[model samples]
Target: MSATRPTLKLTHSGALQALDGALRKAEELGVPQNITVVDEGGNLLAYVRMDGAKLLSRETSMSKAITASSHRQPTSRLDPRNEIKLAIAGGGRLTNLEGGLPIIIDGHCVGAIGVGSGTGEQDVEVARAGLAAIGAEDQKP
Candidate 1:
């Protein structure tokens, strides 16, 4: 077996594009948001805290992005029963919130986007917009 394998990575420009899309969506919804983007390894790529967004949500948004990237799935899909455990295990870096979405491209998860400072549904909607902007697959229903 080969020791090295090819992997898709999220570019800084792509991360910025996703952030812009999420910001536009938040503006359209009249909800300022704290948005974050992270690479597949859960390393931060981009972030934005829109004017009027909840200051405390900045950390939550990053947590959501990191959780999505690490889990390779939407944060909303995580087992609620294990929410506390997951958070503890991640040292508060993981969350079971609805704002996080994995950025899937060509069947691979490249990264993730997360939005906070809005209702769960609204946050997901914004994140979906980000995925759309980057031509990534949105979370399945």
Candidate 2:
């Protein structure tokens, strides 16, 4: 058998820091939002919904987080047509929104953050704050 390879992963403490950062930004913007943080494997690591945030944003935030992690890039990279196709036929595995950002550390994608319930720009801003808290590079659109 071949030797096992090591890989990076986001820790619970890191996820908490990301969540706190996102919430702080949302508060500064005075916009309630739902935020999701996912691991490199596209699994949820942390999530939160501010009071008064639209309930509908919950799933969208999660989807955005998963899409970013799975693609190892921001969701904004997807074209509108592709976004529609993926939403309708690709099992919602992707999104074409600006609120999702990959968490890159040491040139590697360790996770992602997605924020919803505000304008795309606002959401992305919040997500960027989250990434920054973890000392991850921002992958803004």
Candidate 3:
């Protein structure tokens, strides 16, 4: 067998840049946000809960990242009804709240980012800033 199969993955350096960018945006919006990053397989890669961010948002942020990375779509597109089904059906946990985004590069999904602890719109804005940091915003589906 071959030593390995070709696949796209997010680098820690890239994740850090994204995180920094998101945090900066959150500061601009006066929001202390929780941010999460996950691999395409929905595995947690990086995360941060900014000072003053709600402790409850930690799980939600990870859930959003998992939902987006595994489903290859933003959590905003997930309907309420399907949320239950997706979880029960072993599709993995999901959240309907916005701010979750898939990270795409060169036409392939590398991972995802999720932001919480703010209004849905503010979360999304911060998440987009993260994507922009790695030049992945325009690549998103």
Candidate 4:
């Protein structure tokens, strides 16, 4: 077997499915938001921001998703235990509030999705739902 390099890549179908799920759920939750998907290597896969989403949420969502994948942990977990420089908590550092969720499949983390502009809990919910939309919960890096 050859050594495998970690990476994050988005597929057209997967992106559309995640976007659709997140958009629908977010509208139902009544929050205009920015949703981001990044692969395990902290690479951008897909990004969508509904009208009225704060400009800050765009970068924030991306950071959260990327962080989740890079660290193979939820943004919330990293937010508290400051072991990685990318871990954000106070002013600056992606907020680390919540919403970033890891995309795990086959016992491996392949990517992550982040939802912004709603409560932290809502962000996490919608992000999880989005991953479920495409059956990405078991994806691996």
Candidate 5:
């Protein structure tokens, strides 16, 4: 094996694009939201707390993004049996909420988007909009 391999990454611009898309969807749904974007390594790239969004949900949005990036999948798909355990193990960084979605492109997870301050289904819908803005693959039902 080679000592190095090429890797796909989500650029800052892309992260902002995702954020914008999520924002638009939230507006259309008439639900304010706290949105976050994180790289594949779970590093925050972009974030926004929409006006009137729940202030407490800002933290949850970041947690969701980090969880999705770390797990390389939608946060909603995480094992529910391990929800509490995972949270404790992750020191609250990981969550099983339905607002986190991985940004997958060319079979690689580039990053993730997380949204909060709405119903779980609405949050997921916003996250999906973000993924779509960047041409990332949506999670299967």
Candidate 6:
């Protein structure tokens, strides 16, 4: 057998610092939000919910991360398009909701960040901070 070196599929791995970065953004934005980080496989890596954050944000954050990680698409893609329904109906993992973004590096998808409790726009901004903090590319729209 030929020897092969192990390589990581996702360039950016989830980190607790990412969660902190997101929380900092939430504080800066004057909003409390629940944030989640997940690996390429949609497995939770780190999570944090600020005080006064909406309770529903917990599930939103988790689902967002899962959608971004598994679908390699931003949660915004969960637009009521039929594609989203298929993704959910096929038993494919994805939050199909807004406020989630995929972490990328060198044009490669690494992981994902999910933010909730704030407006969709604010959630994107907060999630961007987390990705940037962890050295992940944030070329989100």
Tens digits of per-residue lDDT for model 5 on 29-124? 999999999999989999999999999999999999999999998898888999999999999899998899999999999989989999999999
Which pairs clash in the backbone of model 6? 67-94
**What would the TM-scores of all predictions be?**
0.97, 0.93, 0.89, 0.80, 0.97, 0.83
Task: List all candidate RMSDs to the true structure.
Answer: 0.8, 1.6, 2.5, 4.1, 0.8, 3.1
Worst 10 residues of 2 by lDDT: 89-98
Per-residue CA lDDT of model 4 for 1-141, tens digit only, reads 769977545576677788789888888888888999877676777889999988888877987787777667677775445544444232344445688888777667877887887878888878877888877762222
TM-score, cand. 4:
0.80
Stretches of model 1 off by over 4 angstroms after superposition:
none
lDDT of each: 0.93, 0.89, 0.85, 0.75, 0.93, 0.80
- Candidate 3: Cα lDDT at 122: 89
| Deviation in Å, model 2, residue 49 alpha carbon | 0.7
Q: Higher-lDDT candidate among 3 and 5?
A: 5
- Give the alpha carbon lDDT tens digit for every residue of 1-141 in model 3: 999888877998888888998999999999999999888888877899999999989988888888888777888887777878877775556777788999988878899999999989888899999999998844332
Candidate 6 yields a Cα-based lDDT of 0.80
Full-model lDDT, candidate 4 = 0.75
**Per-residue lDDT for 1-110 in model 2, tens only?**
86996788899889999999999999999999999999998888899999999998998898888888888888899777667777877587577777889999998898
Model 6, position 122: C-alpha lDDT score: 95
Q: Model 5, residue 67: what's the lDDT?
A: 94
Off by over 4 Å in 2: 1-3
Better-scoring candidate (lDDT), 2 or 5 = 5
Better of 3 and 5 by TM-score: 5
